[model samples]
Target: MREVAFIKQNKEKWLNFEKAIFNQRFKNPDELATLYIHIVNDLSYAQTYYPKSKVIAYLNQLAARAFQKIYKTRRQETNRFLYFFRTEIPMVVYQYRRYFAYAFILFFAFVAIGAVSAAYDDTFVRLILGDHYVNMTLENIENGDPVAVYKSGSNWGSFVGITINNIYVGIRAFVYGIFGGLGTGWILLHNGIMLGAFQYMFQAEGVLWESVRGIWIHGAMEIFAIVVTGAAGLILGAGILFPATYSRSVSFKMAFKDGVKILISTFPFFVCAGFLEGFVTRYSGAMPNSLSVAIILVTLGIITFYYIFYPYIVNKKMTLHTYDSTL
Candidate 1:
């Protein structure tokens, strides 16, 4: 593209960013960072193709101004931390919401396959869930405690161990995007199938509701994190596969950054899930059915609202803010 066309294409956006910066109209630092990223990209392009042009100088100035505004804010470090969770992750999630749907669809499909297979063949549950796990659960069921597996370890020990393991799993799901997302898909498939088969096994034994109350106390958040991590992996893979206007390397770099951000954002939820599994799930058998169901529903609601609904809310506010600025 010619310098004039490029400048024309981005001029309004740059002006809007300028207005945002000078007027202090940014919704959050992440919003400023987002605009700065685009400005810098344009500046880089101008410098490369129109080395001696005035447009290059103008973009350089604009980008420098944006940088100063972003970093020189008076907000404390605490505010920055809050902003990351409050605004940054949600914005990123909103930007890549489609990937979330894709991951969920694939996971649900695998879960269905596992459920149907287990329903027809007793051997299928053992095959998917492993002989050791199936055998242990069967023994537990015979002993009248189908979910006794959760009660085996010390609370704090289980919390730390499970938290670390969940984080590791989430990270692996994200890093596997290098394999063009197939690795992440495989991870989701394996886990989803295991989950379905395990549930079906309990259903076969007439303790499906009992199993759900115990498992889903923490499984809601744990499974949601896993699925979101899969979305991050898909985002990374898509970047490599479809560069769009950016070079393949640049696309991959951007995707990796965004994907990593998304993955890191799930760390707190993983810890929460681990805590619930360690402390809450172990007591599910003795707790009232109402309490167990309530916990599961609340956890699911929290994760869903934050990851799915909150993004829409934030984006709407942002859109209105942007439109107001233009007016």
Candidate 2:
């Protein structure tokens, strides 16, 4: 059917339904729900059948406005933050946990491999770090300032540059998912190896513990964001590899949606990481051991809650309330 014919047939019904809903003419809760559902069904069909049609666009706008009204009037906030933690945050955390875990395992495993390689071959650090960076660090260490590289720039300059660079890396990692995971894995591997080599360099200088306490204040979130980006890549790649119950195109679409959500959420984390690297990392030399310990602990706490604890709680609740349609 033509868009006009469809619109003419349904327009009166839709307008009457809207008036009934807006005018508060519902006889009961069941009637209200039924009306809302009809609106939802019509909206879905209109989008599917006449996606670019003016009627569909108008319907979409109408639905959105109506939804806002419904949510506004029915607002019942029993602590907004608590509600977010109890509901949206947990669900989001659960959805991305797989990607997060993949990122952590892949990066850490690479780090471990780097450590073993460094232990076996003294030249491996030189190979990974290049003679220039390795020699520079050694020279800095000899001067009794092992982490002076961070202080090379103005704080604001470093912060803006670093944040922009990290965000670019994250976006690239996400975009690389188009190659069906290979590209994403390669990007992650490159980063993971670099991180491993960097950390091993510090260890070789006999300052691995100090480096961890000092670097991880920001590195925790920074590295975690990289991992999340890797996970986004994996999610995109996985769709290409195995569409499962969906057609390949449909699966790819869904994967992209999920991956985008995960990637966007990491933006704030990257900014925080940049701020720490610029401000806190530059002060690592003057930082007290106590403050370093506290920061490390806090970083660990956040990682633990987001990666382990939050996901567990979400899955547990999901299992318990399997009957709930929202899941």
lDDT of 2 at 64: 39
Clashes per model (N, Cα, C within 3 A): 0, 0
Tens digits of per-residue lDDT for model 2 on 294-313?
87678667856765687567
What is each predicted model's overall lDDT from 0 to 1? 0.84, 0.72
- For model 1, the stretches where C-alpha displacement exceeds 4 angstroms are 1-78
Per-candidate TM-scores read 0.79, 0.70
Write the residue-wise lDDT of candidate 1 on 1-327 in tens digits.
987798789888987887677578998766787787788778778888889988765665555445545544634235777877776677778778889999999999988888999999979998877799889999999999999999998999999999999999999999998889998998899888988888888999999988999999999999999999999999999889976545788679878988998999999999999999999999998999899999999999999999999988866665444434434
Give the candidate number with the greatest TM-score: 1
Report the error of model 2 at residue 159, Å: 0.8
